[model samples]
Target: MKKCLKKLELKIYHVVKGEKIDGVHAGVYGDVTGIWGDVTGIEGDVTGIRGDVTGIWGNVSGIRGGVTGIRGGVSGIRGDVTGIYGDVSGIEGDVTGICGDVTGIEGYVSGIYGDVSGIEGDVTGICGDVSGIEGYVSGIRGDVNDAKLTDNERLSGIDVSQLIKN
Candidate 1:
């Protein structure tokens, strides 16, 4: 019988295979890849994740959009979500969209795009793609490649003295 209905549709898509829509407005469209749960007040266009999006009005685009093993608390994403892959843990809020090539982020992302890796926390509105950042950055506008930070002295962007550790 069609291989027992394709092995019960791959065991019911490995026991529900993501996408827990909540408070339906537009009622979900395409590419919620392997969704787990908690898309709240969605209008349309969710690309991919394991779970937990609080509020999306519309336009959640995708390319390599797989937010793997996500923690929680993404407040907003407008559109053009891209290439966010692997071990995104303890995200706080406010990603306005156009995400690109983000990898293993810790928390508090704002906007803009480029290759980011192993970020820690308080990335106050990332503008032009930081790489290997550690902690306590005030305003990053562009290019802090392979950085490690502490000692809150209000570090600005454009390679602020290679993340000043005085």
Candidate 2:
């Protein structure tokens, strides 16, 4: 019985039991659940621990939005899907959509998967075993845990970033 924000022009949203779809587009979080479309904008932590999700066409999981959690455990971005794991983080326009502990030494994980937080969660994973910060940094700033580019915890406007979490 969740509702989307009209300001974001969100067209769809589906939340099953034990899940939280808190954002524009169509965000679904729960066990054995999946999102197969453009999830352009999301809000707070889309934690879906022990769940399953597939962002078919984009990284709307945290595109302009902000999210953190495990895949199948967390959010689902566009082409940069966070893959899957026990936890995810950050909000950069990178590949793998800013993850935390998703071992992928095989592909070009343009995004990051270290200990970085979502400018929100102090709960970092992976590479953060040292200082709790994003360990990936190439071209894009990769969110280094900077608390300046965060969006909102709730929908209030059309700009996706406007709803990006803390």
Candidate 3:
């Protein structure tokens, strides 16, 4: 019986041992498992994660634990989705994304469709509140402390800090 058709083709599919799969697109299939996993799919997104993934289409992202994807966007810190469309910035804990947008200092998010800036911390997003004073924002929009003081006041008005202090 040819070893039962190679054990029915390894149980119909789902073979990714040792784990590291990347960016699969066009037509899509199934069976994604994980251990030290990293997956990236484009167009027809399929992502399954135990740890570490970067997806596209459906969007996933992660870190410190592992998982990252974009185009639909996801982000994380304690692990799972590290910001692209759904932006996650980190320091403490509590991160959520479903239209994805979060920024951090202390951390706590229930909803984000975009824009929730950071400085002190307390984000409940629907686009607003751009922070300052230890601000390092992620995704959705911009401001990042007035774009780093307008690029250091446009290179210190061309004086260039007295030619770098001579």
Report the number of the highest-TM-score candidate: 3
Give the per-residue lDDT digits (tens) of candidate 3, residues 1-101: 35544434335344445434356335545543433433322344334534443443442343333213323332443332233333333323332333433
Computed on alpha carbons, the lDDT of every model, listed in order, comes to 0.44, 0.39, 0.37
lDDT of 2 at 165: 41
TM-score of each: 0.17, 0.17, 0.18
Looking at candidate 2, the ten consecutive residues that score lowest on lDDT are: 128-137
Judging by lDDT, tell me the better candidate of 1 and 2. 1
- What lDDT would candidate 1 get against the real structure? 0.44
Write one digit per residue (lDDT tens) for candidate 2, span 84-152: 433335434433345444334332223454444454224333352232333332233234443332243
Clashing pairs in 1: 18-35, 18-36, 19-35
> Given candidate 2, what's the lDDT at residue 158?
42
Better-scoring candidate (TM-score), 1 or 3: 3
Off by over 4 Å in 1: 1-100, 103-159, 164-166
- Residue-level lDDT of model 1, residues 7-89, one tens digit each, is 34333332343344345245445554644445455444544444454444556444343344333334334333445554344
**RMSD per model, one decimal:** 16.7, 23.2, 15.3
Which numbered prediction scores highest in lDDT against the true structure? 1
